[model samples]
Target: MKIRVLGSGHSGGTPMIGEGWGNADPKNPKNYRTRPSIVVENDKTRILVDTSPDLRVQLLAANIEHIDAVLYTHGHADHLNGIDDLRSVNRAMNEWIPAYTDAKTWSDIVNRFNYVLEPLKNDTNVFYKPCLKRNDITVGQQFEIGDFCIGVMDQDHGFMRTLGYRINQFAYSTDVVELPEESFKTLNGIDTWMVGALWEEPHITHAHVDKVINWAERVEPNRLILTHLSHRIDYETVSKRLPEFAELAYDGMILEL
Candidate 1:
């Protein structure tokens, strides 16, 4: 399987409009993050995780021509707000795309993007709008997209809950502050893990370096990559602090398993 980190920055992204680069160095390409998103693809399928607000540029830069499905971690603006960009993909493939999320998240999405949620019709014009089929997923239940089997686990994201997905030997957990006991069990044996870490300090709604490292210690994946990073976390500084098998993720980073 091949995993591509389309964007690794937190909600506002690095060099947030008007805020500049914060602690991140302006010269480092790794620090030029877009927003949090990733693409998982193998020979048979291509699945997107979260449509970052920077979706248009990210997809164009990645030269992604097709998407088999989209798995939403939550309905947060950072993750689901760029959903309308899927219309480009819809036009590319000339078909409706399936997006999976939990019931609450799906409900919010349907309510927010009522036009996109409309049922497809024989005379529907996909070019004029995105055609996405919302599939409500149950936590811990396994589902399929092409040849891969995916499982979702509940994650703690402040007052709201999000999802972490496990696909084969790799798992992705973003926008999470804590992993429930059941979530740990679900991620126990992954070979590669893409986990969310907001910064070096503790955060209320996002994982910090210390917390995620502790989880990595217990999960013991072959490689641990920290994503959903904030501008406060400098690439060089964080890279120096990470374990030999772990590192901070950057936009456009790709891992093959």
Candidate 2:
């Protein structure tokens, strides 16, 4: 199996336009972080996780031409705003992409993007529709969507809880403020853990660097890669201070596990 880090930056992404982190150097590639997303694939299937606001550029950067499924972590705009981009893939493949989301998340996406989810008449007048199918995903359940054995884990995002997933030995969880005991135990013996750490200091709604470190120590994953980074935590500084099992993830970083 292979896991590709498509984007690593938080919702606003890095080098926020005119946010004045003092003119990031054009040549410094570290400053070029996109919104968070990833691709998990094997020989038989390609599953996309969290199509962010920068999904278009991220997919092009990764040179991804086909995706069989999309597993959503939540309905946040940064993660789901790129819904329209799947049109090309659907048209070319002549198939509907399977999109799996929990009950709340699925409804939220459909409500927010009514035109995409609801059946509509196309120019052909033969019931032209978006070539994507949204399926309700259940938490704490193991289900087979295609070729992958997916284990759904629960995570808290402060206001509400969201579902994170495990495919093979790699578990991807992000924007997680609190992890319940059950989910924490499920992370045991994971080979690669891709998790979220928003910044250096404490956050009420997101995991800070210290909290992430403490959690990692407890989980003891063989390797950990931090994602969903904010502008406050520069790549250089975080890389230097991270624990041996943990490191910062950058766009286009591929981990073949």
Candidate 3:
């Protein structure tokens, strides 16, 4: 399996508009970051996790033409607001894309994008169709999405409750502030892990460096990558701080398992 780091910037994105804090050194080329999103692909499927407001630009940057499904972790705007970008692909594919999310997330998406469920009208009604079929998921359940076997982990971010997904040998947990002991128990034996490490300091709705490191101590995957980065974690600094087996993910980074 191949995992692509579609984006790694925080909520507002790195070099956030009107805020001059991304790559300060114009001469240094490694400080750029985009909104947080990841793409996982195997021979038979291509699944996207969390479509941020930057989805269009991110997809274009990756040169991807189509997607097999969308898996949502939570309902935050930065994680889900770019949902409308699916329209183009849907028009071409001519099928409702499968969407896997929790019940609350499904409700929120339907409520936020009512046009998706509102019936089509006759004559000259100006309307749009959202190409999504939301399927509610449960914690601790095992399932499959195309060729990948999936395991769900219920997590809490203080701000909201979300799920972490373990597919094949790789497990992904983003937008997580704090994970309960049980969640970590479920993720104990993954070969590779892609998780969030917001910044160096504690945050109300995201994990700080110290927190994730402590959690990492528990799961102890063979390889752990820290993503969902923020302006505070410059590449050079965070890279030096991480363990040799772990890495700091940047936009365009890809991992093969």
RMSD of each: 1.2, 2.2, 2.4
lDDT order, best first, reads 1, 2, 3
lDDT of 1 by residue, 1-257 (tens): 99999999999899988787999998999999988999999998999999989999999999996999999999999998889899999999988888899999888887888888786667766467887887889899999999888999999999899999999999999989988899999997899999999999898999998899899999999999999998898999889978987999999999999
| True-structure lDDT of candidate 1 | 0.92
The C-alpha stretches of model 2 lying farther than 4 A from their native spots are: 20-27, 120-129
Better of 1 and 2 by lDDT: 1
Residue 118's C-alpha lDDT in candidate 3? 50
Per-residue lDDT over 146-167 for candidate 3, one digit per residue giving the tens place of the 0 to 100 score: 9999888888878679889998
lDDT accuracy of residue 220 in candidate 3: 88
Task: Please report the TM-score between candidate 1 and the true structure.
Answer: 0.97
Task: State model 3's lDDT.
Answer: 0.82
Worst 10 residues of 3 by lDDT: 22-31
Q: What lDDT score belongs to each candidate, Candidate 1 first? A: 0.92, 0.82, 0.82
* lDDT over C-alpha atoms for residue 184 of model 1: 92
TM-score of each: 0.97, 0.93, 0.92
